[model samples]
Target chain A: MKTIKDIAALAKVSIGTVDRVIHNRSGVSKKTKERIEKIIQEHGFQINKTARILALNKKYNIAVLMPTVESSSDFWYLPKKGIEKASEEFEMHRISVNYFHFDPLNLNSFKDVFDKLLENSFNAVLLAPIFLNEAKERLIYLDQRKIPYVFINAELEGANNISYIGQHSFDSGALAAKLMSLLINTEDDILIVKVRRDNVHHSTIEDRISGFKSYFNTRKTPIQIHEVILPKIKDQETINTLLHKKLTNHQIKGLFIPSSKVSVVANYVEEHKLKHLKLIGYDLNEENVHLIKNETIDFLIDQDAFFQGYEGTKTLFNFIINNVVPPKNRYLPIKLLTKENVKYL
Target chain B: MKTIKDIAALAKVSIGTVDRVIHNRSGVSKKTKERIEKIIQEHGFQINKTARILALNKKYNIAVLMPTVESSSDFWYLPKKGIEKASEEFEMHRISVNYFHFDPLNLNSFKDVFDKLLENSFNAVLLAPIFLNEAKERLIYLDQRKIPYVFINAELEGANNISYIGQHSFDSGALAAKLMSLLINTEDDILIVKVRRDNVHHSTIEDRISGFKSYFNTRKTPIQIHEVILPKIKDQETINTLLHKKLTNHQIKGLFIPSSKVSVVANYVEEHKLKHLKLIGYDLNEENVHLIKNETIDFLIDQDAFFQGYEGTKTLFNFIINNVVPPKNRYLPIKLLTKENVKYL
Candidate 1:
């Protein structure tokens, strides 16, 4: 095993300089830090983590930003449960957690939450980053503050966050497509429902639709794909009208909801007596479970939302208590839920 | 949350004495310890765990005892994997672990392993405690030395271990009965096979069978429950003779192997071209998966052996590092595995 001395020798720097860079101390010049890191990586240098943790004796606080569970959707509730469990376990080690919530459909709600959290002091942050542009603006301030943050549930581009904990959006969509294919014939039409407020962009939902299209396209299946956008102010009556019109106009064989609004689609399907159509959607809420038990929804793709919060808090705790930087991205295992297994969960 | 001072006042001890007992310090006398504990329980005192950990600085070494995983039955493999993962994450701290392995079938093997581990010092111990009498004798030494140990997989009587991390045996069996009830009719005969080595006692297996029988017994089902025991030594002719005689005499609809030897039973059913016998067994190993995929094994009850190892190691680490005592017994979630959900796992 190569030691720190070997990297220092190869980098043409003093041992102290190498040590400073390795520990991420601020005094080392950027050029020297880069050179030392390159040499260390090339040599596969391994540090005795025990000694490193013993040297660092500071506690840390992590701020978490996520959507609050409301009457519209309860998908965020599971993740909150995970976060609370992690907080209780880590409270003993001087690791404090502060949670901030925003409305999923309102970009301004997210912006306001981010602004308040940035003004407060925190060692680290974990953000869902639902709005692309608003999240980008917050990332700039986070960069200036040099506070490491992790992305959960959604990803933002051009941000130097420490890690990401969520699902592979595209893969999840492809999984949904496969489940849909099992219930519907190749020539049938499928509708993809995207639910959001009128002026808000949902890139995560778009990613899922892209993945769904990609899978069907590769399979050479002659399945017609349609998209439906519902305004945030739309009630069940408007949704019912639009869905009934679409079903009557086209022989819609399957309905795919790309977000947690599956419950809305499920309720429409049940009320309109459209039990013949196959439905695949996201998350496990009370509304979705009723539909699943009744066999109205063929499958529900779960991203293990609870784990995102649980692992995010745990990672921050490990960094604070053990002085360790874990992997930059942690992808949770994708789980497919059906009626048979849903009861067990 | 009542503070330690309140308990001290009620017990007529100094605040320092209460603090020492709460932290498990060695200086507190037995009479004071009992008095303080009684007062604490009466008031339902809860400690500020964060403050307690911050005030104390000490390292701990915990020893683990369990059966080694054999190729024939890889039941213990998952627990070992869980332990290894925890060890990697915890090596940076003052927590070190030593493992002692014994043959699951032999009582003498467990005694020998325990004797050797006792020679070396450990702050705490985690054991499977498969053999009740042998474990009782070994635990006497632990009590004399004032060492704390945890039980996993199985529990021993009259031994005051800190905690037990494993499944509730009866609940697991009840779950199996529910699954088996789904496959066969109430009038069909069911066979219960208890396979074990000659030297090993089958207390857990017996408890499982008792639970399985209780389900049918309460429902007043006409399903005939037959018991079969095979010697530890592998003899195809002997097993074949017993199986052939039982099958010829009765119209067996389901076979429930109350141990990890379900694969052997699965092999017998396949070899003899037996049909219409729904097989329910325990654990997920290479042999069992093969039979499960081939539709020979209908269901397998998984007690989450991996979590037993993971949580056991973590509990000991927390106790040593944070001066915390976990619950007396931690029951892992019982999972029912079938062909439908096996692929996802």
Candidate 2:
């Protein structure tokens, strides 16, 4: 372990200049900083993390922008809990997290919350870039300011993100297909149910559908895949009627709902006494978990939203403080949750 | 945020005495220790962990006893790597780990290793109690000496283990059965293969078998199941011959191997051109991972052996240093890995 004094002597610089360069303070000249960094790298000099952070004694403020947790569906709450956990653990390191929430359904609310978030000064940002276009435009400010940002649940295409911590949507979809293939026989047809208010689908859902079809493409015998894009996500009666109409015409043996709104389909399946249909969906929302426990849902693909949020925040902090560069895309394991294994997850 | 001074003042004791009690050093009187402990607990005083560990400046030695890694099968190497990772992370805390390996096949080698491990002074122990009776006897010596220990892969029924961090064998079996059920239709028959040298099966193997059976018991129409216990684990020809003899008599659609020797059966299955058979097995050993990649195995139930070893070491260190009492049994999640999701896992 080489000391700072040793590096300073080798670089022919004062210890204070070396310290400033190490901590990324602006006092040292560019050439001196580069020379000191090269020497440190050459010797593989490692600093004591806790002691170094204490010596610097700089407070970091992280801005977290995400969708508000709706009372009806507590999906967002899981990530919030994970972020809070990270916040609590990092408090001793002088890291504080300030959260700004927006309505996921309302684009105006997203803009308003993002504007409010930009008004405040933060060392870095952790966000779920839901509205892609709006998020892309607003992220330009972060790039201009040279503030590092991490994406949690969703990501902007070709954006300058430090890391994207979430599921590989397409891979998860393929996994769901594999599970569904096992659940139903080769002769059985499957239905891809999408319940949302708008016709324009998110890239994640579209990618999942594509991934699902890609899996079936590898099969020897082609199985029929039907898609039902319902306009009403929250209106259970309308969803039930739409699903009922689709089921009557086609003999769908397995149902693949590629969204957190899986509990709705599970409810419909349970109410209709569709014992032959094996349902696979996403997320471990309260209702989804309950349905899984009751065996209404055969499988729930857990994206590990909690880990995405937790790791996203930690990634930003580590990058800003320790200069640890995370992978461009950090995919959480595509966890398959059933009645037998859901509790452990 | 209560400090040591506040705790000492509350207990009417010197800061040194409070420190002794906090570090569990033999200096404070019994009554004074109890008084200081009560005050600290009542006030919810949390000492700064890193600073406290630095103040103690005590080097902890942990003895790890497990099976030696055989060159032919690097199954044990995964856990060893995990332990080494933990060892590297905790080096700053002055925690050192000493490894002692035993031949898992031979009882005398286990005894010899145990004797050698007992010769050294260690603060704590982490072990995989493979030979139940022999391990039980040696663990008593550690109990008498009052050294805390944690179990990694397996557990003794009535041992005083501080914590057991591993897969719940029975639950993993149940999870495997669940996955197998999804893979095969109701008409398909399954085979449970046990590839081991001994006739008397370990409790973990038996538990997995029970869990596998228990899962089928819940189904409306029970599927026929056959068993094949081979004499040699390493003899590929004998395993293939025995499996061929068994498969000729029955229409086994799905195969479930309770142990990590699933790779052997996978090899046999592939050689025999058992394309209709859906195989499920345990662990991510090198061969098994390759087979999974090539699509010879349908599903692999990952026990997360690496996490088990890593967490066991961490549990012992935390219990000894931070006084954190881990749960009696910490079950790692039952992971279902397939060709699609294996890469992410």
Candidate 3:
């Protein structure tokens, strides 16, 4: 039943000193803080939340940086929905959010966006560090300013960010490997494809391919595996011809496309009437779902991209509003999608 | 960039009046509040979050009420784990949680626990409303005190609670029916089991049964559907005897248990060597997992009970801290579990 005033009186300190001690704020002397803490423990003093709400008034603004959604893919759209949900919930508490978008393929665009964002102040930030080097450089200023940031979809090493929310890329790849193994015979060859635009280095694809190779190697599978890298250019006919030649030369029984552009390979496979080959890909884009429904893509791995964005924003808000520290890393569960269960999604 | 001083000067009011208006507290005249709001809008003043944290120093207490884990068929343990995880996250925020337990079938014990909790003061409460009338009675007191309470597992009608975090019983049952149909033939007869203690009313179980029957009725299949209600105290021998009689009399080809005691039916089927019948059940208990792995149970419908508890507590905390209103009813997604996917869980 003891209040803050009673604790302050018992500890021979002002109410302001007691408040500072309770909030762990700088200004109160260590000796007075220790004395007040002892009395608070002895009396089991509790703060009345209703009274605190009536007295405190504050607002915050948060900034979110992520890739812009283009017509090619709508993956970034899910995270934007999550950020909007958080913004709506926190608006009553006077918390506002400003969004900044950068092209996933353009590192200079990310640097320019971050430079503009740093000019304005934010209470907190949530970002997807897609352009690693540029993002790391921008985070140095965020560290100096002590503006906490959370990472979604991709993580940066040795950054003192608040948290990271995304998938365990290696495990998801292993899961894809297992699903692909189910569709092909032991003697058949497997093809791994990586597609990228001209100036973009998709590191996530590399991680997934490594995971797929590690799983097959650990299992000691006898199937011959081939890696194919296609440049993002006007050489579509050349790439298609190469694909046809590879299909004719090596009786490829299975294909693993390590990115969201699985639809491109799926279209080629259908056009060539390669119905005997099994295809496993990533994400649930419109084209991918069509191929999956027709059984052209035997399996698709979804990383629950919606939750990554949702959790990322919510985690930052929790820290800002409640003075709580969120977890350092949050990994979304790897979800396997098949024809039978894709409808529920 | 304008501070409180600027707003007060522009509104021709004291800084204290500006502060009072911002906090929405009484003692500020309406005209003065309007003028201060206008100035604030014009200038876009933001409060210093550091000052708010300094002023607010309160510890919150939450109480959780649920059934104790007594039987090997206890799925309630999963939600309890979720509650513990929430407690760990909120510990530094000075949120303390007290647990009260009751037998799922003992209504009087539930009443006694509620009576004691009514005398104890808490900021919030999280409960599993297993018993309808008793829960309604306690909720009336919670409403009068204006203490926000959330219901988990089952919801009561006209409770005026903050939110309900659980599964939609009918949808869950429909999903179960879909999974069961996948494992059986068109002309096969299906048996539905509803198990309940003598003192408890199995509303959730009945809802599931209704959904299951509705699915078959809509399909207009030639398969015969049968229902059985058994007392909780029935011995394994008695259950086995009754099941043998029913199987011989009706030639049941598939069994769908609409309660947590699906493992009991699995045991009877295993002992009687009724391997020909397709079995589907609820929950991920040890016994059920064994049946699933051995292929006795083709599928198990998991409602993600862990998330129900975790999200329930997190929602309550978010409401308390941010003065946010949660959705009236939040239903967890129905997850389908099979032997092929059980390892991931």
**Per-model TM-score versus the true fold:** 0.57, 0.80, 0.53
Which portions of model 2 miss their true places by more than 4 Å? Answer: A1-62, A71-73, A88-98, A107-123, A137-147, A321-323, B1-62, B71-73, B85-100, B106-124, B133-147, B220-222, B321-323
DockQ of each: 0.05, 0.58, 0.05
Judge candidate 3 against the unseen true structure and give its global Cα lDDT, from 0 to 1.
0.76
In the range A47-137, model 1's lDDT, one tens digit per residue, is 6667656634556678989888765348888888888899898666566778899988887889899999989999888889878888887
Q: What are the root-mean-square deviations of the candidates from the true structure over C-alphas? A: 9.3, 7.1, 13.9
Please report how far candidate 2 places residue A233 from its true position, in Å: 3.8
What local distance difference test score does each model get? 0.76, 0.82, 0.76
Cα-based lDDT at residue B17, candidate 3: 89
Over the stretch B1-345, how does candidate 3's per-residue lDDT look in tens digits?
478888788888888888766644468887887677666656677556676464346788898888887664688888888888987886766788888888665678888888888889998999988778778878888877768889888877677677899877776776666656645677788888766554555456666777777777887878788877555535777676667777884557889997667888888888878788887778888878888888777777777788888989998876675434466788775556555456556
Q: Which scores greater on lDDT, model 1 or model 3?
A: 1
Clash pairs of candidate 3? none
Q: What is the lDDT for B115 in model 2?
A: 90
lDDT of each residue in A1-345, candidate 3, tens digit only: 478789888888888888766544568776786677677656776566775464235678889898888654576877787888877876667777888988665667788888999999998889888767778878988878778889988767688677788876667777677666756778899999877543555556766887888889998989889977665523778669767877875668899998777887888889888889889999988888999989788778887777887788888876666534455667776666656456655
DockQ of model 2, rounded to 2 decimals: 0.58
Ranked candidates, highest TM-score first:
2, 1, 3
TM-score of chain B of each: 0.84, 0.81, 0.79
